[model samples]
Target: MTIVFISDDAQALACGADAVAAAFEKAGCTVERVSSWGMFWLEPLVEIGGLGYGPVRVEDVEGILTRHAELVSASTPHPSSSATIEAWTLERQSPTVKQVQGDDLCVGSLEHHPFIARQQRHSFARAGKTRPLSLVDYTATGGWTGLDRARSMAPADVVAEVTASGLRGRGGAGFPAGIKWKTVLEAKGTTKYIVCNADEGDSATFADRMMMEGDPFHLLEGMAIAAHAVGAGEGYVYVRSEYPHAIAKLNAAIALAAEKLAPFRVEVRVGAGAYVCGEETSLLNSIEGKRAEVRAKPPLPALEGLFGCPTVVNNVLTLAAIPHIMAEGGASRYAELGMGRSKGTMPIQLAGNIKHGGLFETAFGITLNELIHDIGGGTASGRPVKAVQVGGPLGAYIHPDQFDLPFDYEAYSVADALIGHGGITVFDDSADMGAMARFAFEFCAAESCGKCTPCRIGSTRGVELIDRILGSGKTAPDSVEALPQMHNARKAGRSRDEEFQLLEDLCETMQFGSLCALGGFTPYPVRSALKHWPEDFGQAGSAQ
Candidate 1:
C-alpha cells in the first residue's frame, strides 16, 4: 500500500510523480517522490515492501512489479527498515555525511569530526544532519534563535556583532561581512536587499551546494537575520543552473520557510551557466535580467547594487555563518579559532585527483601539506602529488615546497596566492603545470565579461605565449635568444611586444584596472606558474 520513487533529478521526479501515482493506484498503493539516495547509476529507484528496485527505466515498470511480487513471496537479501534505508540513502553519496554517520573514521561524527567539529559552526552545524525542509526540525536545532535575538537588538548592534566576529566574505574577495552589512545599513536608500550569491562556478568547490542541499534552512535563517539587521524585507539567492539539486532544495526550503516564517519572503534566482556570475557585480546584473557581466566598482555593491538600491551581497557560507555568530556569542569567539588575520573556520574543498575528495572544515592554521597528505590521503591515482591549486580558478598554483604554508589570507598572499573560497585542487605528477597555467589564462579569457581590456585581451595573449614557449619546434639557439627577449619584453612598458611580455603587461593592466576580482586576479595563477614552474615554460622556444 506504499510506494516511493527516487530520482537524481527533481524535475524528472516531479514530472513523473503523477504518472507514478497513477500506476500505484492501479496497483492499489499510494506513491510519493523523494530525492536520490546518491546512487546515481540506479536512478528513478523505486522502493516497495522495504526493497529497492532500479535503474528503474520507464519501460521496466512491469518487470519491477513482477520482481516485487516475487520478492513478497521470497526472502530478499536487501531487506532493511525504511528508516535505515533512508539513512543509508542519504549517507551513501557524501563523504562528509558518511563522516558524520561514523562510516569514515578519520572524519568521525560530522559534529565531532576534527575537520568540521573543531571550530564554531553557528550556521552549518545542522546542515547535513537535519531535515532541510522541515520547520519543526529547523526550530528544534536553534534555527531562528538568531533572528529572534536580532529582532530584539538595534540594527547597529547586529552590525557591530558581525564586525566583532571578524568574519570575511567567503566569495573570494575576503572583504569583511559585517562591514558590508553596515554599508548597506548606513546607505541612504529607502529599500535595501540581501543577496545570497550561490552561483558557485568553481568546479573544485561544493560548499555552497552541499550547504544548500543538506541544511537549506540555515542559509535561509542567515538571510532572514541579514534582512532584519539591514532593514531589507526582500532577499534573493542567485544559484547556478548546474546545481539543479541545490536549486530545487533551496526552492523547497524557501517555500517551507515562507510558510513557517510568514511575512519574510526569500526568492531564488537561477543563473544561466555563466561562471562569471559568481562575481558579485556580474551576479547582480544577471539577477536584474541583464547579461551576466562585470561592472565598475567605484560605487561598490554596498552603495549601489541590485535594482540600484543599497544591498548586502555575501557568499552562501558567509551568510550561513552569521546565525552561528549571533547564536553562539560574538565575532571575537569565532575569530579566535583561526590563525592570524584569518579569523574563522574555513570549509576547505578537497577535489581533483585526490583520494579524499570532500569538504573539510577546519581552523585556518592547517598546512597545505597536511591537507593533501595527512587529511586528503594523497592522490587517488597513487601518483606523487605534483601541484596544488588553492582557492578557485583564479587562485595560484602552489608547489610542494610551499605546502608548509599556513591556510590564511595573508600567508597565502605573501606566497603570491590567495585562499579563494578555500578550494584545494590536487594534481598528481602527470598533471602539466604549463598546460594548467595556459588553462588559467584560457579560463579567464572565456569567463571575462569584457568590461576591461586587460582581462579580455591579456588572457588570449597569455595562452599564445605559453604555447610559443612550450610548443615542440624551436631549437636550443632559439631558446637562448628568446629568454632575455621575453624577460625584457615583460619589463618594457609598451603593450606591443613579444607575446610573453604582452601577456605580462595584460596581467598588470587587469590587476590594476579591472572592475573586480575576476579580471584583476587572473594573473595570480598565471604569474605563479611563470615563477615556480620555469621548467614547464621550458628554455623559451626550445623544442620539447
Candidate 2:
C-alpha cells in the first residue's frame, strides 16, 4: 500500500515531511504526499495502511514501519476526538475514507471526524482528498460545474444569482460581493478586470494559503464566474511572496484549467510583503508595478481600477465561494445557512496558543466561547483563556467575559469588533493586554504606506504614548490636559490618565483621518484592549 503524506501544509513541511517521505521510500514503500486535512498540530502527519498519525518524527517512522499492521490499529489515540486524527476506530462510526486506501487503521470516514463532522464545507469539501492542479481529480469532485452553469446563463442572471445568495466579501471588509459584482457589471467600461486579493497578510490566517494550494481550481472557477458575470476578459490572483508554494500551485492550476478558462484568462501575480497591500487600492497599485500605496476612494475600483479601468477586486475566500454559489442553484443553497445578512460559511482559522488549532468552516452566529473552548479546546498553554483576537492583527482583542457575542458582522460591530478574514488567535491568562495594544500600533507604524499623516505619524505617536503610560504611574502628561479631571472621579491617577487618554485621542485621529483601513482600524485592538482591561494600562486594582 502507498504511504500518504501532506505535500503542501507549511507546518508539515517544517516538521520534516520530506525526510519522512524519503525514509518511507527508501524502505520500499510507495510514498504519496497529499493535501492537509486542515489540522496544523498533526503534521507532518502520515497515513499508513489507512490510518493517520502525526507530529511523528522521521525516526519514529522506522518502528511503525517495522511493526506495520500491528501498529496500525494499536497506536494510542490522540486526546482530540476530531476527525483529523489517525488513530480513529471504525467501530465508532461509518467510515468515509477519501484517501489512503487500506483497511488497517480502521478510522471511520473523513467527514465523520469531530473537527470536520460539524462543518458545512461547501467550498472546501475536496481540499485534502484531491491532488493540487489535478484537473481530473478536480472535475471528478464537482469542480467546474459552477462555471458550466455560468456559461449557460446570461451575465445578468449570474449577477442576480450572486446578489440573491447574500454573499459578502470574506476579506476584512464586509462589503456585499454581489453589490460589487453588480457595480462592475454596470460600469461603463468595455474593458474590465477581475483581481483576486490573495495577499493574506493577517496574523493566524491560512485559509487562502490552503485553498490556493489544495483547491486552486475552485478559486479559478470562481474568478471565471466573476469574469463572466461582469463581462471581463482578464483576471489576476495577487498572491503574496511568502506563499511561494501557493503561487506555484495557482500558476500550475491555471495552466491545467486553461482549456476550460477560455477567453477569460486568469494569471497569478506575486505581491511584496506589505500588510497594507492586502488593501484593494494598494493591491491594484502593486499589480500595476507602481508603489504599493493606498489610493483614495470615490472613483471606486468598479469604476476605475487595475490600470485606471473598471475592475473587480475581491479576496480569495470571497472569490473562491463563487463556485459553490453558482453550482448550488445560485442563492438559496448558501443564503439559508448563516446568521442575519452574513450568509454562507466562514473558513475560520484558529491559531496561537490553542490546543486544537486548525481550520473550522461554520456558518455565522457561533459563539466565541464555543469556538475557543469547544472547538479550539481552550489555550494550548492549558491555562485560563484570557483573550481571543478576532479578525486580523487590526481586529479587537476579545475577553472571555464577552464570549457570549456571536461571530457575525453586525454582532461584532455592536461590540466595536469585527470578524475580519475570520482569524481567531487565542491567548492564555499570562498574556499582557497592555503589550498587545502597543504592538497593534507598532505593527501599523511599520506597515503603513505613509500616504496619510494620521496613520503614518499617529501610529508612531500612539506607540510612544502607550510606552509612557506603561512606563510610569505618575501625573498626567501635558498633551492630555483634560484627562486628570475626567479620571479623578474614578480612582484618580494623573499620569495614568494622561498617557491612556493621549493614546485614546491618537486612536480617534487615526480612525477618522486615515485613508485606508491600515490607519482606520489600528484603533480597534488598542481601544478594545483598554476598554476590556483597564487595569493593564498602568492603573492599580482596576476591575474587569
TM-score of 1: 0.77
Model 1 lDDT tens row, 106-189: 112223334434334544555333455666666776778887888789999999999988899998878989889999999998
Q: Which stretches of candidate 1 lie over 4 Å from their true place?
A: 1-122, 328-332, 472-500, 540-544
lDDT of each: 0.72, 0.82
The alpha-carbon deviation from the true structure for residue 288 of candidate 2, after best TM-score superposition, in angstroms, is 1.4
Give the TM-score of each candidate.
0.77, 0.89
For model 2, the local distance difference test gives: 0.82
Per-residue error for 221 in candidate 1, Å, reads 0.7
Candidate 2 residues lying further than 4 Å off, grouped into runs, are: 3-5, 65-68, 71-109, 472-494, 541-544
How much is the lDDT of residue 322 in candidate 2?
Answer: 91
Question: lDDT tens string, model 2, 77-194?
Answer: 3222333323222322323233323333233334455677778887777756666766766777788999999989999999999999999999988899999999999999789999
Deviation in angstroms for 361 in model 1?
1.0
Full-model lDDT, candidate 1: 0.72
